[model samples]
Target: MLNTQIKYIDYISKVNDEIEKTNLPDKVIEKFQLKETIEAIEKVELLVPVIGAFSAGKSSLLNSFLGDKKLPEKITPETALATELRYSEDEHIEAVGANSDITTFSIDDIEEIKDRAKDFKYLRMYLKNENIKNIEPLILVDMPGFESPLDLHNQAIMEYINRGVHYIVLSSVEDGTITKSMRRQLENIQAYERGFSFFLSKTNLKPKEEVEEIKQQVQDQLEDYFDITNEIGLVDDNGGESLQRVLSKIDPEQLIKTIFLEDLKDNYFSIKEAINTSISASGKTKEENNRAIQQLQKALDETLQKKNNLIEETKSRYSDIRINAIVEAVSMDLSNSIEEIVSVGMSGDSNALSETILEIAKSSLIVNVKDSMNDISGEIVNDFSTGLSNLNSVMADFTISENWIAGIAETTKKMITGASNKLNTIVSERKKVQNNNEDIDKTYKAVTSVLAITTEVVNPIVEVAIVFLPEILSFVFAAIQENKQKEKIRTTILTTTIPSLKRNLRAKLPEMFNAQVNELISQIGEQFEEAIENKQASIENAQKEREEENRNMEQIIQTYKKADKAITTLANNTLYKE
Candidate 1:
């Protein structure tokens, strides 16, 4: 981890040193994002959220790590949950309100926090704990339990998951196998393109041999479901050593790299392109420069003219078959669980039935939408990247005018050494974003960007569940007669619940996802516009440098040579793969 940090910091420091000698424009310097990358390293935190059932020893695992200090447990309040633990010298606590306001409280005032827990979104504890400090940028969160009410906890957990946190899932060893609730949580995680480290708590309560059998069962279940990034560990009454081992498994170095590598590469490519374009444009005839500018203006203008078309097309493409299948699949999944729900109702667990069914509904829909919507949304954006590449192809043809025959453009003169050029590079203003790396990068951006906003697609279902579930449950229980046949009771519950789930699921599912789809389309358009604008600015800068008699041209080229050499030496030093 120290080495990774040092390497990036050194790389950025060297780039900054070169920037000082280079006479690049402020925009290009900002595009390099050297300072921003450093700041991001400081700001980036690995959120390790402990997610599990109501009495799943989540707090115990967290408390074990805290050692002397502990989270609010046993007496944790309803409609208010999830505690974020971070290290601070101040050693105080903060109450983040439901609407995100902050109120300060002393560590001893945890009782006060519990009294008004309903007023808080979650409690943020700043402690001087050694374990917390040892992890540095990793922040541990006791996320709301999987069985928490749909009105509150589901949305909260969903939001946190979208933030790209690693989850530590804890369940009681006594539970034998993965519970239905845990299964739903696991599915939700999988749908978000994430996996978790499973921990079995209260292991001390059971025999060692029994623990082994149960652990195997849980491990087998996870492997059956996923490709298994399982770091299955055991925690007991005392927060077991497995807590630290599981916590230690999250490599901050990898997280940091995953966060910034692609962007850093992007900046390098873009700045290099700008440098190339500047050098090439220095020799173009005023006639050739004007033609390029005209072509750029026409492209930009056409983008504006076609902005609505792009949005409609993306929304249309995503909505047609894929989203419908996902929504319908949610209904089918919920319907399949009808017997289980009927059994809950039949057993007279009326209070839990509604919440249980709600969990199934919300989880099924959340999983289905995330599984389909995120990928589809990503594919949609990658399509834009490809199309943008094609646009560059058109410009490629235009840039190949008489100026290229004389080899003024660097593309004509130089044999590029890298695997690819950027979509909106200054030099490769006429190149398409058709490379594998660029496609993957764009797809990553599309998925992550959509993820941040995709929670909107699931929130309506939760809102509907709040009002719909209790009412449907009431109808179901009322219709379920004491002397009724078992099949009749099942039919009663099914008729009552499935329609409600399907209707509500269908109602807002499409609308919400489509809304995000359109928003992503708009965002993709903005990125495209921004990229094209950069190209235009590069040309204008070239025209300015040309107008100025190219006095600094050689100096700029020297800086590029140094930068190019440095980049080549460290090209493969990054932690992320293509």
Candidate 2:
């Protein structure tokens, strides 16, 4: 196996050296991601990403794993950027910036790193610790906790996906068996084929039976959603037996071989094929070239079909999550708004009630919907960025545009306008009641106006609610006629007002809010679909160009076939030995 690794590495190095010597068109070489593949093969470190919700003991677990308090542990969102712990002969921490510049600094510089977190893309802390020596080739990546900005967290994790980084997903039994945020992250990870192990951290905070229950729950949930090969375990901050369990579960040597072996084999075959194609250099008869092109065309069609399906699946998953999250938030906000309006109606000041309803609708309700829209938009942008990053190495001229952001912003404004218009209609109707004329008739008119709208928009059950409201108002009027005390009259009105208002709102508002939220969802879906359609066109064009390039290299294809068979045989032998 060692001989196989050496031979494979040597062959890949020779192929790259040959490519450089030939000095082929850079554009042609890049189309196959040959350069990136070479770099991936040359790198020795295996990235083990530690991810979880904020304050889920990721840093503590790492500190325990290293047998050193190297990472700052404050139970806060520490290590703002993605911080990495790698094996080094000499211990030190350095910050890597966006422009590929590195800064070596002392422990005191952590404050500055915190202050300028956004500026640094990653922090690499190299250490020579005895505890981590056995896992020398493994780089433990502690991500910015999921409690960070959704975009930031998604961005960090998506980079891991593009680079094929496996994960050490952490969750606390104390927080819950699983949370909505953790589920979302896990779903995103599951989109790609990779290895991951879950650790239920902070188990000392729970009883043994409870920990067992949590572990069972996690296994059930993950098995339903993911093909998790590595089993889940319980770990505490002290990290003793649990720590050993985690270490054994994610043994660095086995992990490296499992993740990289297949990937290395794939890239190895691809690079070898590229080399063979270059060596033959366009020397084939027209008939032979036509036959090869036909084969290429068929493969391209199947690849494109699978790519489209994957893209559609990703988009659908994202949209469902976005809609559900937005709708839930809007429903809660609208329910609260209705409750606030009902509470204010008890005062019997129609003017104050109207003002309160409008305040809640325009402020809290609108803000909730807008925030949801923004979150969905951010997610779309992140997805686009992720897709484009994967493509950029192969398609240098391809670029992603943020032009849809403005359009989404405009659509959200229109949705908010629709909501405001609905609220404004109610407020305007309230203004027309004549308080100066016969007071009881005027009050009755106002009550009936509200009831009319509610019953008209919702259901007939409100009729029972409306019946009670008129009688309550009539009793208040009678109290006034008898020259009853102001306090007594006010109390009498409230006792009836509160229950009537609640009955009307419970019967009416949920349906109305849900309809509005659904409408907004439809609008957002249209925008997302449009974005996806544009991306599909781009993928088709890229695939066509790739096919055309292959068609012109029929002789090269023949050579690649021979080279591929040799590598496949060697790869099988290595796998058999393992």
Candidate 3:
């Protein structure tokens, strides 16, 4: 995967080189900002945000998961800026200003840090915590309680929305409902490309039955009011098994995996679009190269006919075979990868699964498409280079924009890396689930759900990325002009013949490629969804079997009186005082 990333970076460098050679108008280059987008591929990180209203036990919940009172808990509606906690060798903090300057601070300066956060964009806390050791290379942001300071909430949303950041929406069970403001936050968070999980905080304060009722109510509210269908997990205020259960639901590794692939796919298509725009917008003259243009048209007509015939023949003979091959290969790959990870997770050893899935992500269709760009470029160049020496200069110039091939390659590499990081977070968080069969059951459900969601989110985008630039033939003809061809036979080719060729290739190639990719994605998605269903069914069957056994044991053991307490434990009482 890392090798692919390096190759991808190299590909981007090459594309930049091509862009420079083309000397595209400054406005076009600036409009696309292809260079900046290419550079962003490496810097992308999955933002896992924790957000909720004040006095909702948000800080307590995060502190419990980290096994330390890291975040400052407040009783009143004291405004706080967004704060990101990441792993570090030495504990420290940095305030990142809106203008991009950083101010470092010692860990002891709590008041100073708070003051800085008020004026700063966000504060980055570097902590060495054993609880989150497995989730290294993670950025867990704790934003100001939603609705605390309106501007801070908006700023947080605007700043991190596009950076592949998913959210953990925290709502207190004390209210037993979703508020209007909270619904608005949910709407905003769901608008991004990333997925989100709902966290019902202070679940321990209510009876188990009451807690379950609250969850149902919230889920129904989500469906009725917002039409959302996200999983909501219980976060015990006392930080026990319930807390672990909630943590298990928001798998960081899975988030990273999904977001990376998503971004990579987006980046690849954007580059293709930019290259196409640049080519279409290039300057052309009709009268100056009329003779050469006529010869070019005749040649292009002959060449396009041959190409079209070849595509049709291939489509007739090999289309089904290619589709089956792709579906079979990807299904086997995804099945093996998912099964292996599920097996490990069910065994209470999810840590080893990240590397395995990362390997699988490396071989996804988008990555494969990116990897194939160079060969595809070479093939197009070879196919067009045949039977004409007069058009070689033009063909060569057309091939220069093939630099976008590298850009595509680079995007896929980043996709895998991002997914790998998120997978790491999932595994790391899973470690908090103790080595018990009960926790293992929870692990199974969590891993299965994450895998299913990942498949659903990633499959369509891969299809799009693979088919984004179906035929490079359009850009290939834009550069074939000779200043010295006074009156060549192909001069008309530039105006009439080449445009027709472009239309034929555009019309045919995309249809063929799209059909193949759509079939591949559809087959894979079905197989994956079926696999998830089967696994879920098996787990349910096993649980039923266990319940039957437990019932028999309960009858044998005889009934005992259960203690009923008059006073309930308050969530705030157990929170770390700090």
Candidate 4:
């Protein structure tokens, strides 16, 4: 069975070799490589590199797994350098330098290494212990934390991680929040062919309840912030055991077999077989070849159409999500502004009145300022979905077009290439323009200045209103006095005067006491107008971009149809000639 598997692998490998030599599409090459990698996993043992932030217990975890504190200079021991554990007949740790120079050292010698020896990028150590030797085909490498304060340490760690097949991400229990940088790193890793395991290290530092709480919080954060739903493991050294005990709890052998080995082997063999079949049947009779090509093209078109539809749907969903987020943010700001205005006005402290009014106006004006700016995020998602849908639809239609299915495939390849180039250009230009628009800073400064002025205008009025409370009362009394007959004066004063007094106090007090309030409102309105103007400009630019994209897509479609027609015409003419 092993021999047969090897023969099958070899045959697939040869087919891939031919495909690579030919100028096949990148997608085809990627699919071929994906298959080969899976097949190779069955024969070769996979090595995974474990990495994390500082104080994340990467070394401790490794030590626990090895059942010995032998992984030289474990993470917290002295931050000496990064260490790699591999299987070899001889047991020794060696530092390898830039020019492939290697120097042998004992675990204790790590402290003595200073300049050039310390400068070594990667440390390779062989396990001499009997227990470690029993574990087949897997090596655990402990790397320096990527976020180490030491620049050299970080650089060396990243270099090693770049070459790793799998990553074990260690995080702290106290602060389970992944920083933006860490999130980016994880996202990049996710894009590649690697398995990721998140470990909340040093669980013993906190109580069981606290640890569980932190885990839940981290899990929620990962889901909300990164959309990662994977189960995360929490390991603590303080759980009545040393590192060895903790390591024993985790079955590295099972982790390797289940996560990496089996699935990869299966995928590799399947891909290898597919590639071999495609290449072997590459050259057949013209009619037979054309028929196969047509089928493939039809399949491609249909796939493209399906993908396009999915993209459109996703775009719509994401657009809604984005718009809702914006609307909620703006609404909250507006509510807060109104609340602040009310609070400050009612405080009855004249001196602080202007400052409060100004703050309210400023807050209210800035709420929708960002909305005015042309945000292409929504449109980009929409267009991306549309483009995908169009491609898929074209592919689906082409699948049934026996006359020019092959030509449709060629046309799609060209269209995708062109679209990719155009997308890159558009993105680059948009970024440049946005970077150049330092007007946001200027607008912010202007708004701040206007808010200050608005406060200055309102403060005095608020103070006067508060101080002349009796005079304001007299004015209401006078108005009520004018409306009443002598007999009804007491009744009028009791029933109508107090209510009118309250009403006038509520209405006229804001205007009379907070005179600067109106000025502040005007300033806020101006700022809002400015923001709207800026956003309008952005909207115009976005609309222009959208129109251009639509035109380009239309042209591409027309070109494709023309090519299809020409191919059909030729095919028909050739049939008649034959």
lDDT of each: 0.65, 0.51, 0.47, 0.44
Q: What's model 3's overall lDDT?
A: 0.47
**TM-score of model number 3:** 0.43
Tens-digit lDDT string for candidate 3 (1-578): 23334444555565455545433334434433344434444444546777888777777877877778877887333458778877788999888887767988877876777755557778888889765555433467787775444344445644554343567778999988996557655654443335667878887788999999989999999888667786677887665345456555656544433444444345334434434332322222323233334544655465555445545554444344443444344445445444343443333322223223322422443333322322333333334344334444442332224543343334333323232333323443444444544545222211212222233333443333223322322222232222223223133323443344334333433454444433332322232232223222322322333345334423221211010010011111211111
Query: Candidate 2: minimum summed lDDT over ten consecutive residues — where?
Result: 442-451
Q: Which lDDT tens digits does candidate 1 get at residues 424-507?
A: 222122122334244432221221243445566777667766876777666677755465356766787667667766676666
Q: Which stretches of candidate 2 lie over 4 Å from their true place?
A: 1-7, 11-39, 150-155, 227-230, 251-578
Candidate 1 whole-model C-alpha lDDT, 0 to 1: 0.65
Ten residues in sequence with the least summed lDDT for candidate 1: 412-421
Q: TM-score rank, highest first?
A: 1, 2, 3, 4
Of candidate 3, the 10-residue stretch with the lowest lDDT total is 559-568
Better of 3 and 4 by TM-score: 3
Any runs in candidate 3 off by more than 4 Å, and if so which?
A: 1-39, 131-133, 240-578
Q: Candidate 1 — which residues are off by over 4 angstroms?
A: 76-80, 229-231, 312-317, 320-323, 375-448, 480-486, 550-556, 570-578
Query: Which numbered prediction scores highest in TM-score against the true structure?
Result: 1
Instruction: Using TM-score as the measure, name the better of candidate 1 and candidate 3.
Output: 1
Candidate 4 lDDT for residue 443? 21
Better of 2 and 3 by TM-score: 2
